[model samples]
Target: MDLGLKGKNAIVTGATRGIGRAIADLLADEGVNVSVCARKADEVAATVSALEAKGVKAFGQVVDIADAAALQGFVRASAEALGGLDILVSNASALVQGARPEDWKAMFEIDILGAVNALDAARPHLEAAAGKTGDAAVVLISSISAAEAAAPSAYGAMKAAQIHFAKGVAREGAPKGLRCNVVSPGTVFFEGGVWGNVKAAMPAFFEQMLKRNPTGRMATPEEIAAATVFLCSPRSAFTTGINMVVDGGISQRANF
Candidate 1:
């Protein structure tokens, strides 16, 4: 199905690999120009080249989302390079799930503040794009862990915070023809990712998690990306301030 996202410009953070990379690639597949950022220069370049292969303009930069200056710079530069911004996907995370104070701080800085800073930097361009296209979107890559916390975890807390933040953003941005939403994914596995490593080093734990999913498997990065892109699409123009959970039944809570 046509997503009506052709020619749109997007900035996706942490797009070097995993779910972020999936989202960026899928956006390019739908004919959207994408600007992506990662800390590693080689990964950034390689991802950009791959996206460009899909016939859309792709830009990449080495950025540390924990650094506010660098994060904002990448956003502004991307908007300029793409001509305007129609979508912003905040997918970067420190992945600090530990209970330590420093872990909490790092998660807050990278996960929560990263999304805030990106939206702030992209607001002008999104507003401008709205003027011409009548719509704009921002999707936060949160996690199901937000509602399903089993222990003291900074990651869960910050992911939950993102959902709250996006709701407020949705209300404020709607008047400007902008939509804001969250995509909370469950355990998603990919090569070289956390789960993949767990599957290799901790086979018993990995099997436990796999069995916990009624589907008998964790979600693929592409599954999460598909949900996110749909929410960001013009076809879902009326959708905002909603957390779309793409967990493949691994998360048992019902949406209220």
Candidate 2:
């Protein structure tokens, strides 16, 4: 299907690696211009170069999405570079694994506030772009943790709040012709990422998750990214304020 994403401008946070990088690449492949950002300047630069080679208009910068001012500046610059913003993928997150309230709070700052800040910063640009093409969307890369408690435990709680935050953005943005939605994924492995550590020592955790999954496998980042790109594209024009779960039936929670 042609997603009808040609020439659209998008901003993808946390786009240097993992799921966010995959999302950016998918958008770029669909002929969308994408601007990416992450805390690592070199990683962002490498990602943008690769996308540009794919014949997509792509650029990037370094920014801590947890910082409102930094996020605002990145959004402004990305909008200007891409000509405007029609799709915003807020995917940056910091996961703190500790059995403490402080860990949860720290995760909230990056996972929840970061997504909200991106939505706020890109709202006006998205509205304008929507006005131009009658299609605009924001896709947040939340996790199944929100719906189910995570191994880290605290991560899931903050992610659940992220979904609600996206819903709220959708409600407020609807009148302006912008749609906001959440994509909650499970077990997306990033190369050399923390999730690998969780999977390594937690044999019981895998068994528990696999027992619940009809697919009997962990979700790949690419799988989740494919769903996300569809949401941002014209294909899912009417979808808004929804959490599209990408778990392998893990969230289904069935009793054997």
Candidate 3:
């Protein structure tokens, strides 16, 4: 029941809303000292306040992960604020648009480059924690799109690259007591946003999405967050360099 998370410090990127926010709240609830970040200063402060209400130490920063230097500064600040870092959840970026040549830049910048920035900056702190308890872990928030073609172009390709890079990081960092793994969520519904955007921008595509999934439903952010926390916990001590997919059987059916 303890989850052994009390006093453990964590950094959750993109923590102002949606899945990142949910993950931050859950970690704080379990007694983890958490530092959350977003590009907006007000949103970061507000999110930290919300987490503080849960009675755990929390910090927030305005970090544009697309900028490596800024993200490094944010990580260092988070470590300084929390006294140390034991867990890192790299949950940054908007799910990029598909592989039109124009979408390439933004997709790679956020999805690929941003991940490199966070993981690199947090390695030292995470390594120190691993040295202390042999349990420090980095959880890369990927998507089920990595395994399927549903998400299309830039998003899907970059995600697949994330998985490969995560594995390489796991192998390199494992010797230093660091662990890295990827968590992929399928069709996560982020209410009042994408679903609605899809309805207005492209209705037929949305309908096809609903029909492709065997469960006739999309996953909630909380459901994905639970799996994410498990990966970060001692519960998954031996799990690394893997992609744990959470899709309502969406990726399994080849012929829908």
Candidate 4:
């Protein structure tokens, strides 16, 4: 299946490890020029080298997603480096699960505002790309926690807010051929990731989470990345304003 993504330019936030890294790699594999940003200079450099090794133009920079100016700057720089931006994926998060006020603030700053800032910075480039290619996309990485509620969680609340934001972008950008969508992953596991740390530190809780998935396990970062990249592809030109859940049946709610 040719994704018709070769030569397209993309920017992915937090594209150094886990799902973000997987998405960046997959995009490179599809022959898309990629620009990535993360806080760690070493990881960002390594990721760029790895992507360039795949024979695609790649750029990276150290960026703090919580800082609006820094994040917007990265996006603009990336668009300039990559020639233009056809896809934008906001994958950075604060990963704050606590109920404290500070935790909520962190999530709002990094997750909510980060997505907003990235879209604002990339909108012009994306719209210009749409003028040339007839399609442009923005994929927001969200989570199944947005639809589920067990306790007070800033993470879930902010994720839900992202979904709402994406919907509005989708509607507003539809006429401009700028698509916006959300990909909600559930219990993604990778080495040194949240689930991996949970499995090592709290085996019982990890096992409980595993059993909750009908697949009898969790999703891999690659699995989530596949869904994300596909949504950004020209083949999915009409797939906008939709929250695609790649949760391995862990989420029970049916999409209407």
Record all residue pairs in model 3 with backbone atoms less than 3 Å apart, i.e. clashing.
Answer: none
| Backbone clashes, each candidate | 0, 0, 0, 0
Off by over 4 Å in 1: none
> lDDT of each model, Cα atoms only?
0.94, 0.84, 0.85, 0.96
Give the number of colliding residue pairs in candidate 4. Answer: 0
User: What TM-score does model 4 achieve against the real structure?
Assistant: 0.99
Q: To one decimal, what is the Cα RMSD in angstroms of model 2 from the true structure?
A: 2.7
What local lDDT score does residue 44 receive in model 1, on the 0 to 100 scale? 97
Clashing pairs in 4: none
Ranking by TM-score: 4, 1, 3, 2
- Name the top lDDT candidate: 4
- lDDT-based ranking, best first? 4, 1, 3, 2
In the range 1-256, model 1's lDDT, one tens digit per residue, is 8999999999999998999999999999999999999999999999999999999999989998988998999999998888889999999999988989999999999999999999999999999998888899999999999998789999999999999999999999898899999999998999899999999999999999999999999999999999999988999999999999988899888899
* All models, RMSD in angstroms: 0.7, 2.7, 2.6, 0.6
TM-score of each: 0.99, 0.91, 0.92, 0.99
Expressed as tens digits, the lDDT of each residue in 1-256 for candidate 3 is 6577788999999888888988998899888999998988999999999989999889988887888899899899999999999999988865776688767777788878888888788888998998998889898888877867854578888888889989998888877778889888888777655665776788898888888889887777889888888888876788888888888788874522
Candidate 4: which stretches are off by over 4 Å? none
List model 4 lDDT by residue over 119-150, tens digit each: 99999999999999899999999999999999
2 versus 3: better lDDT goes to: 3
What does the lDDT come to for candidate 2?
Answer: 0.84
